[model samples]
Target: MPTTTRSESTQAALLEAARDVFAEKGYVNAKIADITGRAGRSIGSFYNYYDTKQQLLRALLERFPAQIVERARDGLSDDWAANIEAAVRAYFHTFRDYLPEMIGVFQLSMSDPDAAAWWRSQRAYGIASVLALIDAVEQDGDRIGLDHHVFASAIVSMLESYCWTWLAAGGDDVDAVFDEETAIHTLAAMWRRAMVGES
Candidate 1:
């Protein structure tokens, strides 16, 4: 592998530090000082990479979908059940891996219009993927029996909310923390059932 340059290394450090800080303190409450401190770099160095915390957070968020796609690619299959399971598993792992970005984007989106728009764009991407899957299923003579657009939207919403609730928000019941495989299987089964009526 090609070696990373000094600038690239510095930026990587900053991003990693930002992720940790965001996870611990959240986007709104996290400070530049904290990130810099965690990164073991001066505050000035952070600006050399990103203009603001929002920019850093955006960078992280941009990686989320691509990571999921990459992980899910190998698991994708012609079977609808396998496809849903693969997608759900990929999303669950990616969400866990990028929990900090998930938390940051969600918190920032609540107050910033640009952030909110970005969040919606992310959801739109998922919705489009779902619609494509729906089309494929229909072409295979499998009737969905629901409005394609609405079904796509609802599926995306369900995946997003469920991941956020369990992973980021810790769910409602403190005693109910789920194992990774169980969570992924549960989501995959639910999604598969929604699409084809049997998990």
Candidate 2:
């Protein structure tokens, strides 16, 4: 294995420190001083890796798609239901695992055009995956009587919003608590039903 350089180590420390600070203080409120202080690095070291906190947050956000893809790769099959279930579970867990990045992107996207565009691009990535799934299903001689693009967009939106509502924003109903398995199954069932009219 290649040894990690001091520069790489410092960059990793800064990224971890930023995640912690963003989690505790919210992205908008977190300061470069806080991140550097937590990382035991100088402010100048931070500038060497990232020019702004937004750039650091973007670096964190970049990991999200890869994590989702890796997690969703397991248990994939010709069966659409199984694929949908795996994808839903992967998304839910990844959202929870990377809550800081999700929170940072959502908060910054409101005022930052670049962040907003990044957020949209992330959603588009999900949409594209769904569209590919649709293509595979159609190639298997199944007909979905809807516009493919709209259907894929709706599926991605549902997954994104539901994950945000439950995992990030807390559940919508205070009295209704859902376990992880239940939530994943419900979302997967909805997606599978919408696609092929059976769960």
Candidate 3:
């Protein structure tokens, strides 16, 4: 029992260390020794849990909260605008919290076809969420002319790209402070306008 507990603790430490190192040095640049040093564990110990840095990154991706954006819900109200805001807020919050892992996964996607597919899968979750909301709106007699799948894909791309640009790489204007509420509200308003033709 004690041995199992120790193993779990070591794994947990390695994960935490990887998160920090990946955030600081980035996934592409981070080394196994750096992760082990941060965890205060030997290099060999890292191998006990993960065979490579990519595997560690995959583990982190598995733990990311992708479901928040994937499973967005509509409130029991007629105001679709507010519902959009709520959904955008949910996605923004999730991305803000896991910016590092998002960056890592995105970086991996560039070099690895499997990671690219996984990235698309994550986007698919966002696409599905948007589709659900759009379907609800369409059922209420609104005529949606655009392609739902393409539109949803664009929205997800916009959110992910903008968040990565601002949250992860810092906003273009270094002097400007990051405002969470304003960012969410702005994206939601734009999305609402594009989706329902209302501001």
Candidate 4:
């Protein structure tokens, strides 16, 4: 029992350390030695839990929040405007909470096929939630003239690109300041207006 407890504790330390290292150095540039050093564990200990850094990334992705899936599965609220705000808040919150993982996926996906697939799956979850929202709006008797899938695609892109632009890249202009409330309100307003014709 003591051995198992130590193993679990070591694994948890490794995972947390990996997140910090990946956030600081990015996945493409991070080395196994860096992760092990951050964890204060021997290099061999890493191998016991994960064969490669890619496998560690897979583990992070596995634990990625399933909010989108849960939202889609649970159905949306009857209050369309409130729902818009709620969805936008949830999206931004997720991005903030998992900024490092998101950055790792974005940076590595460019060069790694597996990473690319993982990134796509993340987008797929957002798309699924957007589709469900659109369906709910339609069922509420609003006519969404645009192709629903395309609209959902656009909405997801807007949310994702905005988050990446401000959160990850720190926005284009150095003088511009970004905050959580403004970001959430802007995206939520856009989503609400786009779906219901007024913010």
TM-score of every candidate relative to the true structure: 0.92, 0.96, 0.86, 0.88
> What would the per-residue lDDT of candidate 3 be over residues 18-124, giving only the tens digit for each residue?
98998899999999999999999999999998988888887877744454745345333577767788787777777777777888988899999988987787677
Q: Which ranges of candidate 1 are over 4 A from the true structure?
A: 174-177
Best by TM-score: 2
| Reference-based lDDT, residue 48, model 1 | 95
Please, what are the lDDT tens digits per residue for candidate 4 over residues 1-199?
Answer: 3456888889998889989998899888899999899999999999999988888887876745585445423444768777777778777777777888778888888888987887777787778778887887888888888788888889998988988898888787777677789878888888878876874
lDDT of 1 by residue, 143-174 (tens): 99889899888887888898899888868767
Q: List lDDT for all candidates, in order.
A: 0.86, 0.88, 0.82, 0.81
- Which residue pairs show backbone clashes in model 4? none
Model 3 clash pairs are none
Model 3 — which ten-residue stretch has the worst lDDT?
67-76
lDDT of 4 at 169: 87
* Tens digits of per-residue lDDT for model 2, 1-199: 9999999999999999999998999999999999999999999999998989999998988878878878888868878779989999888888999998888898999998988998888888788888988888889888888899999999888988888888778779678877999989998998888888983
- Backbone clashes for every candidate come to 0, 0, 0, 0
C-alpha RMSD values across all candidates: 1.8, 1.2, 3.0, 2.9
Q: Give the RMSD in angstroms, all C-alphas superposed, for model 4.
A: 2.9
Least well predicted 10-residue stretch by lDDT in candidate 4: 67-76
